[model samples]
Target: MKLISWNVNGLRAVVKKDFVKTFEELDADIFSIQETKLQEGQIDLDLSGYHQYFFYAKRKGYSGTAVFTKEEPLNVHQGLGIDEFDDEGRTLTLEFKDFYLINSYTPNSQQKLKRLDYRMRYDDALREYMQKLSVDKPVILCGDLNVAHEEIDIKNDKTNHKNPGFSDEERAKFTELLNSGFIDTFRTLHPDDVKYSWWSYRFNARKNNAGWRIDYFVLSDNGKKMLKAADIHTDIYGSDHCPIELDLDI
Candidate 1:
C-alpha cells in the first residue's frame, strides 16, 4: 500500500490552490495532512471513495490533522491520551487489522526556545504513547516532527545549530524516539541522499534548495521488512513542505 503524509500548513489556504488536484494525482491508498489550521465546518472536501477523519484543535485556525483513507480502518484514535496535548489536535491514529498509522504534528519550539519546555514534555509523552502502541502492533508514524534530526537533514546545520528546529534538545528527542524503536524510513532507504521535505518561505529557501528534512515517515522495527520505498516528493508544491510517500509491501 502507498501512504502519503504532508504538512499542508493550512488546509483552507491550500484548498484554494491545487490541494484537491494534488490529492488526486498522488492517488495514495492512505493520505494524511497536518497543521490543517481549521475548525469544524471551515471547509468541506469532496474526496469520493475515501473515508475522511479529522481532529481539530479547540482553537480556531490552529494545529490540526486529518486522514483520508481508501480502506476503512478498524478503529481510529485522536491524541496521546493526554488532555493538554489533545486540545491542540496534534495527532490522529487509525488502526488497521495488522498495524497502526499515526499522523502527528509535533509542537514547535518557538523563537528563543520560548516553548522548549512544553515541546520537551510533549515529545516525552508522544514517545511513551508510541511505545505503548508498538507493544500491541507495528506502528507507522508520519508527520512534520519539527526537528532537523541530523546535520545532513538541514542545509545550514552549523549556522542553525541553536535554532528552534535544529536545537540540541529537539534533535535529542528525535534520537530518543529512534533509539526506542522507530526507524526513519527515508534515511534508512537513502542514507547519503540529501533531500528535504520542508523549506522556509524567506530568503528564497525553496528556490535555492536550502531546506530541511523535518517531515518523516517513521516505522517501528516490526514494519522495517515491509518498507518497500520511501520518498520525499519535493516536486509537488502547495505548502512550504512537500508530500512524502511510503510504499509498504503489506
Candidate 2:
C-alpha cells in the first residue's frame, strides 16, 4: 500500500494551490496531513473515494491533523488520551486489522525556546503512548515532527545547532524514540540519502535546496521489514514542507 504524509501548512491555502489535483496525482491508498490549521465546518474536501477523519484543535486556525484512507480502518482515535496534549489536536490514530497508523504534527519548540520544556514533556508522553500502542501491534508514525534528529538531517548544522528544531535536547529525544525500537523508514532504507522533506521559506531556501529533514515516517521494528520504498517529494509546491511517502508490501 502507498501511504503519504505531508504538513499542508494550512488546508484552505493548499486547496487554493491545487491540493485536490495533487492529492489525486499522488494516488496514495492512505494519505495523512498535519498542520491543517482549520476547524470544523471551516472547509470541506471532496475526496470521493476516501474516508476522511479529522482531529481539530480547540483553538481555531491552529494545529490539527487528518487522515484520508481508501481502506476502512477497524477504529479511529483522536489524541493520546491525555488532556494536556489533546487540546492541540496534534494526533490521529487509525487502527487497521494489522497495525496502527499514527499521524502527528509535533509541537515546535518556538524561536526563543519558550516551548522547549513543554516540548520535552510532550516527547515523554508521546513515547509512552507509542510504546503502549506497540504492545498491541506494530505502529506506523508520520508527520512534521519539527526536529532535525542529527547533523545529517539539516544543512549548515553548525549554524543551526542552537536553533529550536536543531537543539541538542530535541535531537536527543528523537534518538531516544528510535532507540526504543522504532526505525526511521527513509534512513533505514537509504542510509546515505541526504535529501530533505522540509525547507525554510526565508532567503529563497527552497530554491537553493537548503532544507531540513524534519518530517518522517517511523515504524516499529515489526513494521520495518515490510517497507518497500520511501521518498520525499521535493518538487511539490504548496507548502514550505513537501510530502514524505512510504510504500509497504503488506
Candidate 3:
C-alpha cells in the first residue's frame, strides 16, 4: 500500500496550479494534505475513485486538513476532542481494516515563539491521543509536524536553532513523542540521508535547497514492520512544502 502526505499550504491556490495533475501522477492509495486554508464548499476537487474527508477550522482560510483515499475508511474521526485544538481543524483520523491513519497540522510556535506554550500543550495532547489509539491498533501519523527535531533536519541548524520551528522546546517534544513507541519512518529508513519537505518562501530557500524536514510519516513501533519504504518527494511542486511518501507491505 502507498500513502502520501503533503502540506499544500493552501489547497485552493494549488488547485489552480498543477494540483490536479500532481494528484493524478501520485496515484497513492491514501493521500493526506495539511494547511488546506479553506472551509467547506470553498473548492471542488474532481478526484475520481477517491473518498474525500475534510476538517475545516472555524476560522476561514486558516489551518485545516483533508484526506483522500482510494479505499473507503471503516470509520472517520474529525479531531482530538479538545475544543481549543479542534476549533482549529488541526487533525483528522481514518480507521481502516488494519490501521488508523492520522493526518495533522501541528500548531506553529510562531515568531518569537509567541505560541510556544500553546504548541507545547498541543504536543502533549497529540502524543496522548496517538498513544491511546495505538493501544487498539497500529497508527500511521503524518503531516506538517512543524518542527525540525534534529540538527540534520534543517539546512542551517545553527542559524535556525532559536527560530520558531527549530526551537529546542519544540524539538524536545518531538523527541518525547518518538521515544513513546513511535518511529519517524523516513529517518528510520534513510538514517543519514539529508532531505527536506518544507521550505521558506523568503531568501530563495527552495532554489538554494535551504529547507527543513518538518513534514513526516510517523508510525507506531508495531506498524514499523509493515513499512517497506519512506521517501521525501521534493521534486513535486505546488506549495512551499512537498509530499512525503510511505510504502507498506500491508
User: Model 3: per-residue lDDT, tens digit, 1-250?
Assistant: 9999999999999998889999999999999999999988988889999999999999999999999999999999999999999999999999999999999999999999999999999999999999999999899999999999899999999988879999989999999999999999999999999999989899999999999999999999988779999999999998999999999998
After superposition, which runs of candidate 2 have C-alpha atoms over 4 Å from their true positions?
none
lDDT of each: 0.95, 0.93, 0.95
What's the C-alpha lDDT at position 105 in model 3? 98
State TM-scores per candidate.
Answer: 0.99, 0.98, 0.99
CA displacement after TM-score superposition, residue 13 of candidate 1 (Å): 0.7
Model 2: per-residue lDDT, tens digit, 141-248? 999999988778898899998799999899999999999989999998888889888888899999998999999999998777688999999999899999999999
Q: Which stretch of 10 consecutive residues in model 3 shows the poorest summed lDDT?
A: 159-168
Residues 157-181, candidate 1: write the lDDT tens digits: 9999989999999999999999999
- Alpha carbon lDDT at 60, candidate 2: 94
Off by over 4 Å in 1: none
lDDT of 1 at 43: 89
Model 2's TM-score against the true structure = 0.98
Candidate 2 vs 3: which has more lDDT:
3
